[model samples]
Target chain A: MSEIRRRDPRREWIARNRLHRDHVSVLAVLGQGNTPSEWLGPNGVMRRNPHAVGFIGPNGLKRIDRSGGQQGGPATVATGTAASDSRQAVTIEAPAFLVAVVPDMSGGRLSSHDRDLLGLARQLADADPARPGAVLAVLFGSHKEEALGEAGVDRLLHLGDDAYEGYAPEARLAVLAAVERDLAPRHWLLPDSPLGGADLGRRLAARLGERPATGVWQLEADAEARGKNGSGWRCTARGAANTRDFLRPLPRVALALAECAEPVSETRHAAEPVTLAQPLPVLLSRIADLGPVAVDPAGVALAEAGFILSAGNGVTDWEGFHHAAKLLGATQGASRVAVDDGHMPRHRQVGATGTWVTARVYVAVGISGAIQHLQGIQSCDKVVAINRDPGCDMIKRADLAVIGDAALVLQALVTLVEQEREEKRHAA
Target chain B: MRPDPQKSPSLAITVLVSVGCHPLTGRGRRADQDARGVELARALPLAEVRLLHAGVLDAGSDAALRGYLGMGFDALTLIEQPESSDVVPALAEVLADHPPTLVIAGTRAERGEASGLLPYLLAERLGWPLVAAVAEVEGVEGGVATLLQALPRGQRRRLQVRLPAILTVDSAAPAPRQSAFGPARRGQLAVHEVGEAVPDAELVEWVEQPARKRPKRLKIVKAASARDRFKAAAAKAEGGSGQVLDGVTPEQGAEAILKLLKEEGVLRR
Candidate 1:
């Protein structure tokens, strides 16, 4: 076999080096020498370094051992004068816990966001092999204790009261700030739910004077090896085109997105219930519960919907499109063209510049699946595209492609659904 | 609670404007932050609103800065600083010299080192209470302002914060009116010089790679039974199989979809 010549500069560089390209890129970008320094203390391990800045990497802070030998397994906290010096600056109360501020699940069930936070807490606890911390679930309202225990929460701090019924950011902030002051946890984790998590996280961070990484999807912590300076957390946030990783010292707060971390299996941990010493301070007085306002059924927010029936330019029969959506109990969504053409309201538009949806099932009716439109539905689990053109991007990306007139397909589906429901009722 | 009309005279609103860069195109445009910030400031009836921008003026940024000017503002105070310099210290200095009753800004700039850390860092520097995601300013009275904060899913919360606080506007804030060309052409861009230049700590190497489609996230399955677990694993491994359904009747296609939906558990019988 003849050796093939590569044209691309990046590929050629990788081929010449024969080393991990990411590691080489980090060294080249930071202008660091390629002498593998055994920098971690005995038992300390360097996971992976993407881009290096001084001691910081994509993973975490790296300690450079000038002695030059990769003899250590994973860096463990070495007892020495340097460690003592690092510890002298800050005093930490032992038995540090990973606290997750979780909201009351609407129906007493754990949301995926809740699960991600629990998983994050577990990871943070496991990071510190020396003194494995406990995962604390701070519940704003009453929840199923069994679910919390099964989610691997070691402790449950329940703040159940009539006043804490609905989502109140101010009240939650007061309680969380007080909890932080009382418990003094090493890490405070929150899901980046706009309902309250993002707001609460930012407010708590501001209150505690800690810089937080919001909408973080990946995070790693070194809680066990608390040098004089204490441990630090490395958070990775995904942007449109790039990924940005932030490294902040321990006693920090972060808001992780719902789907960021892989949730671990439910563990049966003995849940120890605790209460706040002081009552939650009343920051604001509620004037009245106005109840839910009436909104147009056709104009539903795309982001919150579990199932969406989206219409595009190809959708001419608005009545059929809406009827199908109603019959299937799916929220109506429109592409930019549909909204621009006044077929649907502006709020119903879903794309890059419009609402982003993470629905369980997204049915595209007549949507050509433009890049922007696809971007909006990227998080959708199962996509069923109905398009006239067989070669359209929508058909290629969909889990199920129905090559037919969108109106006919939608009408048929709606009729079939209605008939099935009627038959089931009669059979019962 | 309603804000008192009598105390409106003492209110002074300062809106901070920054260059918003488009992430994908890298084009300098009127930032969504400044647009919302400007609109929020304009909404206040009795308060005197001043527009401020911090950075050395360039052709790309001047155009974006003028966007605020186009929205009926006469002049924008540009605190001259290098693009690479940290604007926090300079911003704090200017803010200290001419302290306003309330400071409003966008949550974060869109382009170039969009850390979303400015509001938090600025609040820390000024030692002021920071309020995020403000949808509307309900009222300001007696050194306190009533704000309707935006929550996820169109819910709003009424919050009262003491004056001399910093607020970052969310997208839920009323959409800004289109900028008039005549006013934008006539608006003044006043520049102020600062003493020091803070060196930029370019920690993360930002390589502009072509945007790639995001990989599908693994669905978290919590099945207890072995059969259920096996089914879930198989579904994930297969990545979903589908038929093209070419030349098929609408009835047949609907049936196929219904079967798939039932298999995926998206629909109930």
Candidate 2:
């Protein structure tokens, strides 16, 4: 069976002949692989035997292309797509009560953190299907977010008035007060983020005299603490600079972390417009918004940097590193050695002993990552290393490692980035 | 009460400090934000800064409180409050008694519940304007404080909060200066006997355990058919061993890095 057998000429000719009526059946009679596969059934159907077609791969896994490419009938490529999404449009016309959510809406868009907060709102709202509670999203100021309904908001109370804009926590809190009086929401959920939710949420909780549960990461039904009405929910929240966890009863107001619960991906809600029954009261505010200050990204704190350009002892060309960081518009971070050498400020140090950074993209230029440095950047989504030594721990941890002189690599990168920017500008 | 606005009056700044717990090792330390608040207070020109704390002084808390005093303070006022009691009332009362020109504090403590509701609650109780997430207090002029408030992604908003305003220092604020050993050792902890302990009603009811690691979310492919699911399941886990570009020219390495930056959507046009 291992040897390549000479084909029978008569059968081959018959199978090749288009005019032959038995040609189709004869084709099937010609088995596929090293082993005989299948035969033509009496009803003119080809019975497939898959084991005969495929060979075991190097890792001892069976490899087979079920696209019918072996004996092509236009290859039954099953690139099947779902006709429609899994999302179901839901409307809670007469909700028993309301659960309010106030999103940060930074840059006039609902951030991922906002979406997660809304997800938590949905959980509390849809906890009991028998008497579903609607999620009322109080969106102050102007927001460009289009899919409020898709984000699991049942009622959208948008106050696009100029008064609700920037640094107007007083006016925003007034609107929230109106919400508390009118809707009397059962629960208020906000993101435990610094953008706006943390500030506004804390104010809302304080103004309402409700003790809030901040940094809540998870919620669970406590059977032992179940009330007469229904199952009472408890939560685990980060405490004391995130050193400890506090298990506390789910408060009327809950400031949750990102991914506390998954974002609403399975359902779309009716984003019905809501208005306060009574006109909003004008509260005299002592605080005034002077607009935003123009700050260099490099001067920003390492903990909040979305992208970081970090330097270490191996970075001999300090001037070039700074230039590259500026060109890249990244926050500056440094290793302990760099800081100790007076190259970078103490505040710019990145490590367990320094500031724990959660940068999305951390580029370590010439850094031999110490354990503390790695610990500080553990929350970073991706790390890119440009190092002279390939065996450095930073290189091992990096998703992409460029083993070369850090100075040269950074210089070349800056040039490429500039070129790309030029092309983009021209195209635009 | 605010000072008479006739002349260039000196400001009396009160900083509310708290015991902080280290994240890695659960030892007591000066809370980061609170330390920053102290630093912010100290930076204000012509302002006499006073540190206030509301917690029991003990072996564990002693180290934490001393951590605050080590920031070049001769002494810090301490109110003897219990471990699990609400400190808002005691702190609010103290503020009302003294009535400083401005109240500066961290948004939250680094110990206990750390709900970040202290300044807000104090402001509500005192009926004063509260500014949260403050990075820096620029200046005080004509009873108005010009401040820099921290926003997400390192953005800053300038605010003019009327004096007697409560400012909560943001984590993004300038990092606190090192606490010197001399100041820490010499600084005295003045113990003040305060009102009865009011237990945190809600916190006392719930159970607490050492935090279990939050499960990392897996990439869920919403496949329609079994074949797609099979394909997704059989796919190798990505980034197991990173792509190392060794022996490549700097240009090639840069090009690769640029590509990755583009793919990550981090490179701005």
Q: What docking grade does candidate 1 earn?
A: incorrect
Q: State which candidate has the highest TM-score.
A: 2
CAPRI-style class, candidate 2: acceptable
lDDT of 1 by residue, B1-269 (tens): 22465865546778999887765577877888679888888878766778888887889998988888899888989888876687878888889899998899887666544546677777767867777888888787777777777755454667777668989899889999898888898999988777787855543332333334445676666653465567777751233365588889999889988887776554644
Encode model 1's per-residue lDDT on A1-428: one tens digit a residue. 66983334553344235366575665445343453232222233443333322243346756443232212312222323333443222111234565555643643556777886788877887665677677777877766536566566777787777666554655677778888878877778877665456656766786787756665665655554255346555556543224333343334687777766666563455457777777766665322222333333344467967678899999989988877777676788989999998888898889898999977789899998888988898877779988999988888778999999988988889889999999999999
Off by over 4 Å in 2: A1-82, A228-231, A301-428, B1-8, B182-186, B230-269
**Chain A TM-score of candidate 2 vs. true chain A:** 0.59
Interface RMSD of each: 11.8, 7.3
How do the predictions measure up, each by TM-score?
0.58, 0.69
The worst-scoring run of ten residues by lDDT in candidate 1 chain A lies at A68-77
Candidate 2 chain B has its poorest 10 consecutive residues by lDDT at: B1-10
- TM-score (C-alpha) between model 1 and the true structure: 0.58
Positional deviation of residue A272's Cα in model 2 after best superposition, in angstroms: 2.1
lDDT of each: 0.70, 0.83
